[model samples]
Target: MADKQDKSQTKPTSLQATIAGGFAGLLCIAPLDVVKINMQLQTNRLEGLKWAKRGIVHQTKGIYKEFGARGFWRGNASAQWLYLFYGGSQFFAYDQIKRALAKTDLSSESKHFISGAVAGTFATVTTYPFDILRTRFAAQSKDRVYTSVLDGFQKMAKAEGFRGLYTGLAPSIVSILPQAGLMFVGYEALAPVFKELNLPFGAGDFLAGAVASGAAKTAVFPLDLIRKRLQVQGPARSKLAYGAIPEYKRNMFAAGRAILQNEGPRGLYRGLVIGVLKAAPTASLYFWFNARALEILVQNEIFA
Candidate 1:
């Protein structure tokens, strides 16, 4: 084991490992993502939105009944692209920035937060178009406005200018900056706790990812909801959206105020419950795959 550790320490850490984990996590949680988006976009206080109040099980059944098995994976393609770019860029930047900060006197938490916030901003801005496409694809109903991610991109850009693709970017950055920081902090902190418990191989990584994801997600869920809402705005709102689509017109505060006034604080957290649940396996698989893939790469000296 000592020899193995020394050999592993000598191998280069590959960003590809993080990308692979993101892909795996996306596949595992795609269906839940679809449900979560639908829930987030809905408003129970609005007319014709009473159905939105139904529990997750009912929502899941409704979606399956209407769109069949395919419904649950509406935006999976775009999501795959988003996760690939976001995860790779985020982790790569985080690793680089963290290393640079290691020589500083900043607390570990400060380093993690700064690194994560910067990484999240970089990744979110770079891959944000994919995220918008994913939201539109998932939030739409049977009367699909955008046939596919590429189609959605072309149509949205044509109709609303290229700038339309980045609607909600401000709120996304605001939320994700802290969200990303918290996720790293949670994962770094929780992993050691789980390790101390002497769980099975990779179990610590999995739990750390899950717990970290849940905590961070909860912290920024309202902003996430706002971002999703804004993504589906413009020409498609009247035609293809699922529930009461409030036109915030890029104003996150208006969106928040509207949701608060209309549905109380509960509206802001429309999909929080399901989101947290999904985060469990989603984050677990992501980090586990990351850790395991890094191990394999080191053992094989693949990226060295």
Candidate 2:
């Protein structure tokens, strides 16, 4: 194990590692992504139950049947543009920002939290349009909605004005700040305890990520639900309506209020199950790959 670790500790720059992490993450999480979007796009409780009845296995099979095995990657192209730059910038920003704040005398936890949030916000805003397009394509039926990502952008712009491309900016940015911030803080803060108890850092990261994603996800799931719902808004798929959820289609707060009033608190967490299942691993590998990559960079004095 030690020899393997030593040998593996010479990969690439931190920027490269972050990019690789994003690409690798998209692969690991794509199926879960399909499941997650299907779950999120459920406009009502009954619609959600339809998915529950269908099950992950069946839905996955349906995806394959619809667009073939590659259907699982329906949004891969747009996702690449989003995740690649988002991932690289997020990590790089976190490191640079944290370093900049090193002399500030804030608590270590506070610094970590702030760094992660800033990084997340930076990444999210820059590549946000790709995010909207990715979700739209992911939620699309085999009908091949919007043709391509660029096509989707063009259609959205023509339909809803330029603002069409950024359906969930406000809620996403707000949610990401706390979500990413606390997640990183939790993961970093847990390191010493894990080391004291002799746990592997990677294992600790995976567990911490689960806890972080679960907590953050639950808190902001309504916002996330809003984001997903908003992303798939303007282009009404002529083929599928899921349900007549016209009450909350206009804006975030109204949508949130409608869900809480109609579906109660549980409405916000429509896809909590698959979401966390996807999120935990996503965050875990994000940190694990980053740690390994940074180790290599440091060893090579590239990060020195």
Candidate 3:
């Protein structure tokens, strides 16, 4: 019975399952993500556009009232592509790296951290352009900047050159490395404990993922806000963005310093609650869907 039960579970992580899970998670979190970006990008530099300064419910209602239902999913196309590519590559890399590291004498926490960081680096660099586009689309409330994802790419490349496509790459990488590492460490540590609690179906995975994601995201959220700020700060921001925009032309540190000087420390974490809200459930769904998809695939002898 024990052997049969083991066979019924997913054998490690599968790329297809990871991608499916990420896409599912994205669908669940897109609206909150849009609002989160808007809130993060909001600054005292801007007046008369304090809509995002309110709570999540208020901001959400404002989005709907102003831009209608579709407003909640402004950058969903870019986001979907991001999850598709990043999810597959990151999980595949993590699995391979973890397996390779398994023979080493490193501690389990160290191994998970290293594997997650490396995988996150690879995936983030590969899909970074999509991330910028997603932020751009999400941050744009007053004006229609890029009509579509392809158009956004073309415009970014044409207007700002190659650098535009990777505006906040440094900060993004820094933030993601620790976030990814912590997420894996937290989830791995919490999953067994949650399972031991005799939770309902998917509850263990969901709770483990939620706690992991919430903690990991909150830890590096300031850098995340800085990344989003830098992403939308070029010509488009100067002219078309909803409110006043503070320019951060230098590196991530400079951006952080600027935010600190202008808006204080709380400014660095403007959208923290919304971010936690989005990340927790999104990660919960990701883990649950990944497990379910892997089980289905394995049962069907699909991907092995």
Candidates' TM-scores? Answer: 0.93, 0.82, 0.93
Worst 10 residues of 2 by lDDT: 238-247
Best by lDDT: 3
TM-score of 1: 0.93
Pairs that clash in candidate 1? none
Can you write out model 1's per-residue Cα lDDT over 23-70, one digit (the tens) per residue?
553545799989998888887534565445687987888788878999
lDDT of 2 at 289: 66
Tens-digit per-residue lDDT, 1-304, candidate 2: 7865764665455465555455544434777876777667665444543433365666666667766877777787887777667877787677778878989989999999999899889888878888888887787765666688889788778887878778878889989999889887888887556656656655665666667767777667778887887777775544332433343565788778877787778767767878888887877776666665565565555543
Give the residue spans of candidate 3 off by over 4 A. 1-6, 9-28
Quote the positional error of residue 84 for candidate 1 in Å: 1.4
1-304 per-residue lDDT for model 3 (tens digits): 7765776774644555555545553445788889898888888865664655676777888789889999989989999998878877777788889989999999999999998889888889989999999998987765688989999999999999999899999999999999999998888889899989988776898899999999999999999999998898677877545756777874999999999999999999998999999999988887777666666766666656
Q: Which regions of candidate 1 are displaced past 4 Å? A: 1-3, 14-28
The CA-based lDDT of model 3 is what? 0.83
Clashing pairs in 3: none
For residue 295, model 3's alpha carbon misses the true position, in angstroms, by: 1.7
